[model samples]
Target chain A: MDPDTAIGGGRDRFPSTEHSLLEAAAGGLAPEALERVAALYWKPVYRFIRLKFHKDNEDAKDLTQGFFSSALERDFFARFDPSKASFRTYLRMAVERFAWNAHAAGKCRKRGGDVAFEPVGEDAALTESPEEAFDREWRRQLFRLALRDLRKLCESAGREVEWRVLEAYDLAEDARPSYAAVGEQLGIPETSVTNYLARARRTLRKLVQDRMRGVTSGERELREEMRRVWK
Target chain B: MEVNSDPADLSDSVVDHLRQVAGLPDLSGTRYELEGEIGRGGMGVVYQARDRQLERRVALKVVEAALAGEAALIARLEHPAIVPIYEAGTLPDGRAFYAMKRVTGVRLDRYAGAGRPVAERLRVIRRVGEALAFAHSRGAIHRDLKPQNVMVGEFGEVYVMDWGVEAVGGTPGFRAPEARLDQRSDIYALGALLQFVLPAPAPAALSAIARKAMSAEAGCRYGDVEEMLADIGRFEDGLAVTAWREPPMHRVARFWSRNALLLWLLTAYAAVKLGIFFWPYR
Candidate 1:
């Protein structure tokens, strides 16, 4: 079943920007909208090509850039049907098919020009199947984008202490410092550290949920995606 | 430090994502300094904090930014069974949070499973009932009452936490099958709590009380928490409970069950007397 149907009759409760991006993509790939969509999905696409297709990093990066550059010119996103599949699944399938066609035509020529996408690391486990690799990379990208947004929010709001506390307490868990230690480092009371961490966590959860709207079909899918991303 | 090549776990990924996000300095201007996370639920995350002015530890429940309006309402509830909210306010980032006494104890279900005597369990339940009774008197209904929401404190304090989600989200298994939740719904949850605390094959008197509280028809349940508390009190004092009318045969059977060994010896003596009486004839 289409995940949208499971989320109660495809009522789009997400913000209008996501819908507008798709509409623009369908109406003839407006440059600004296509760029936004590309920026959002490029990391996942590049990682999928590198890990799933076994292409070297440079070739994978060039192919990812080439696919999006061509997809914009050829109106690739117009083919996406919300009733058929989620945007994430559709994009993954589209990228995979693009890779196969490129290899078939022997046109794997470098054409990235000035795209400058982030490099795909070699750390992804090779044991995963293509679908698993695509999904893991996609979720990782979503997390990366959401984190970027959260940083912007914190910077805008001047909550740097809360952000630092969260970084020390949550992100540095391998060598996790006690709240008292973080407090001493920050020159604040331990209780303040705890409060800041809680605030940061709550804000991050909201921001991640907001970012998930672009890919999820509806509220149910959004919730499911959030659970998977944060699980 | 060596970085692991494998992908980060879900929790680690979340933390990494948070770290990457732009952070803000401490913007809250509250009296309490947060210590650490105490617990979390569907509505909010609670932190253990120290109230600087009061010089005491408190559980600060920071609710979702959208649900900040509930903090004041929850703060108004002043009952021993309910965690008393001392202060409520919005953080600089607009999330709603409140401070209440930090209850140090396990959840009710965990406390019940600790092999405590039945009397102790009943006493704890009674205290909880008293708390609920107080809330009901103040026209507050704890629509989300459950074993998890009830805290059994270290010094035998019974506190019912998480009143923010009252009349909103009900636990699937504990909620009554009612169109509109009211005091009866809380009563049903209390009945469920009794079943959770009582061991299998609970004594007939207590089971009857639980059954009446969990009656399918709302009208058939106790008139109020006070009535239920009264029945529990009666049971504790060895008086006949109002929940069930004991039939003459049932009472006799219960008495016999309670003193089975003594009854068996008396019966054996009677049988021997009869046998001796008949021995002369034999």
Candidate 2:
């Protein structure tokens, strides 16, 4: 099956430029839209291809890049029906469909270009359900994205203390330090430490929710995805 | 198009901690203080919290499955059998949260399993149906009704819960096949709830009522929850139910069973009068 097989024919009917691919053929691919979609989904897509399709790391990376690149070229995201399933479920189903097509095609050739991620050669076994693992990887990436944004926001706004406190309190890998101790190290009172921690966490939560909102349009879908991400 | 954030120290523990912080409801501006998590559902976590101003413990639900819709819907619905929302507002993260009367009770499914009499379980369903009736009167359909969404208190208070306003969603078995929800759709779920409550080898009359209400065609089912409750009322009163057409012998048996004591007294008096009337000495 070719890339267009995932979406049925009669592509000439869409009324707006919002459904790309046809628009991509006219102007060019929407690079920002394509990049945002790929940025959030590529890790899970790669991991899912490796486990569910039994593809090697290199092949899974190729399919991951191929699927997203093709997704833009064929107006895949616009065809999603939120009523039938959540976007997460829809994405999973689409990845499986793409993988099956690749398997049937004997080999899924590299579509866009070389993948930017290096495949970890040693760790390839499944430790959990592939769907759950995919969800976890997606969530991990979401948090990573939010964290990255939090750092940039803190730096730009000259609120580095808030980021440092959040990093020290919530993001600590070892046993977290007491509020008083963290205050002593950061040269602030314990009360200010408490206030800063609350402020930073509040910001982080909003940032994470904003990231969630970026994916789905509906309020209900956003809330459901919020619960799912936390779970 | 590029992958980053690999070496930034988001290990499993860090992820768990970050998720915990994200899930925590920020109650800085509210009158409630979080104690701990009570439980979670499809929507969000319910926390056991204290209302410092009211000096009462309330169940605080931090909404995640909907924006403000669930809380607002719940706040509008006020019935003794329906759980009442006391106060609602947005959390710091912009998710809605509401404080409600902290109900101490068993879910209807577990309560039904505890060797209770069939009459007692039927009564629980009646209260649930009444709550739905009140909601319907206010132009709201529960859309999702099941045994799990109902709670039976120690003093027999019934609280119908988890009233979220949404579209095209429900638990599978309890949900009616009809896509568009109306009063009848809730009737369908109540029927399923009744079926869940019934013990195996249930009374045939009650079983027939459940089956009729659960008919695949929505029109074939009870017109509304109140109408269904009336059928249950008929069964409880030893009268024929609208759902089931009792056969000739069963009707006779039921009549006899209902009037057995009076019939025996009348028959004995008539035998004595006849003996005195036909006595040879007279």
Candidate 3:
């Protein structure tokens, strides 16, 4: 594949591991990998349908789920050539193509065929282009998965206080409590609140990076992706 | 809320996830309000925000929590080429964020990419050199000095950014081949930037200067940004650059090259006058 096809520069030196995911799926060594791919991309596909294709939420959800099930059954990933494009771009193109074919066949609302993907709702207004919406949704999905993992980590480690502190301060848009306020609310000292939040942010950042690495093509692309995610 | 398996709840959670990933801080209580993201780097993301108390817009760089200390240190740097930090504080989440003067212009790479005149590009690079010189004088090294890290304002102002990653490490392809990074490493990066902005087959004198700055051996590069700036100044003034040892023939060629238009005009004038003078003789 033309390394430059990936996002950032220095692709020649640092190849991304995303290709391996495709390879594993194509080789049939791991059905779980394909399932993971479906889980990661389903929301972005659904969002693309709703925003770009102008489908309603219910129709978008059905089309998204149906597309994934059909693609998996047909071994769609095996046809992907990383040399031709980055996995993100390739997957986006595949989703668009699948949606187009389904629409042509008048199967946009045919539900219960297979692949019962989770229902993801449309949140923000469609202010961006379809491509922009797809990219943004992709990033949101990555963050959501990373956050879920972070929550698991916190629960296992008995760091509910830290998790709550982060949720209040980082996640809450209304009444974002200060460190002192969070401390008072949680019955901890302000200094401890600061330390816990710091810990949580660090852990979250690492988890985000780890999740990004799974999809990105190389170190440079990973850094570029992370920068975009933060931006 | 009871155990809810409602699809609407799932959708609400998705919206909540979007809010967190948006990285928009609730600055309603703070003096600054988030406007939008202007730029981003590995260390931090910069948002264009309005300082409500000050009634002005500023660029707020909110770094990852781990780099908070570095952000604070960068706020202390004062230079014309460096983006001036107006204030430093933490988000409620404890991430280190600082407000700086919001510059309205493109990155140096983009600015240079527009095919601006060579002189203008050099001027921008010189401003960056001035910033680096001041920084090194203050015992700080800008380890990352690529074109992306430099911003050029609409009014011809230049500002260096992302000091949060300063002296931390260098960007790939710009990193010096040295175990210990210091002032010379920045000089090397300046050389890379010069190569990036300068036209292909750059003037012999300027290419030599870039070569010296990007020398493999750290000691071989310019000792400081000022010295490199001086060489650039000399090159701009049509004088022999310190970086290049021009032979007499090459110096004459360079002189001709610099004054090619004037020389062409002079040659035309002389030919016209000579033709008139020889008219009667003929």
TM, chain A, every candidate = 0.76, 0.77, 0.75
lDDT of 3: 0.71
For candidate 2, the lDDT comes to 0.76
Model 3 TM-score, all chains together: 0.53
iRMSD in angstroms, per model: 8.2, 6.9, 8.2
Tens digit of per-residue lDDT, candidate 3, span B109-215: 78986568899989888898888888888777777778888888888899987764543446877878886788888899888888788987588888999999999
How well is each residue in B1-282 modelled by candidate 1, as lDDT tens digits? 222221123343544444333222132578877676677665566778887888998888876555565556557777777787777777765557777778788898788885688998998888878877887776766778788998888888888887744344488767888868888888888887887799877888899999999998999999998899889888776667889999888878767766788999999999999999889867
Estimate candidate 3's RMSD in Å. Answer: 12.4
Compared with the true structure, what per-residue lDDT tens digits does model 3 show for residues A87-205?
A: 77888888888888867566445554743443433454546777787786676566656666667778899998877777666665444567787788878999887677667766776
* DockQ of predicted model 2: 0.32
CA lDDT, candidate 2, residue A191: 90
Error in Å for residue B252 of model 2: 1.0
Model 3 residue A34 CA deviation (Å) reads: 24
Q: Name the top TM-score candidate.
A: 2
Determine which window of 10 residues in candidate 2 chain A has minimal summed lDDT: A1-10
Report the number of clashing residue pairs per model. 10, 0, 3
Query: Would you list the rank order by DockQ, best first?
Result: 2, 1, 3
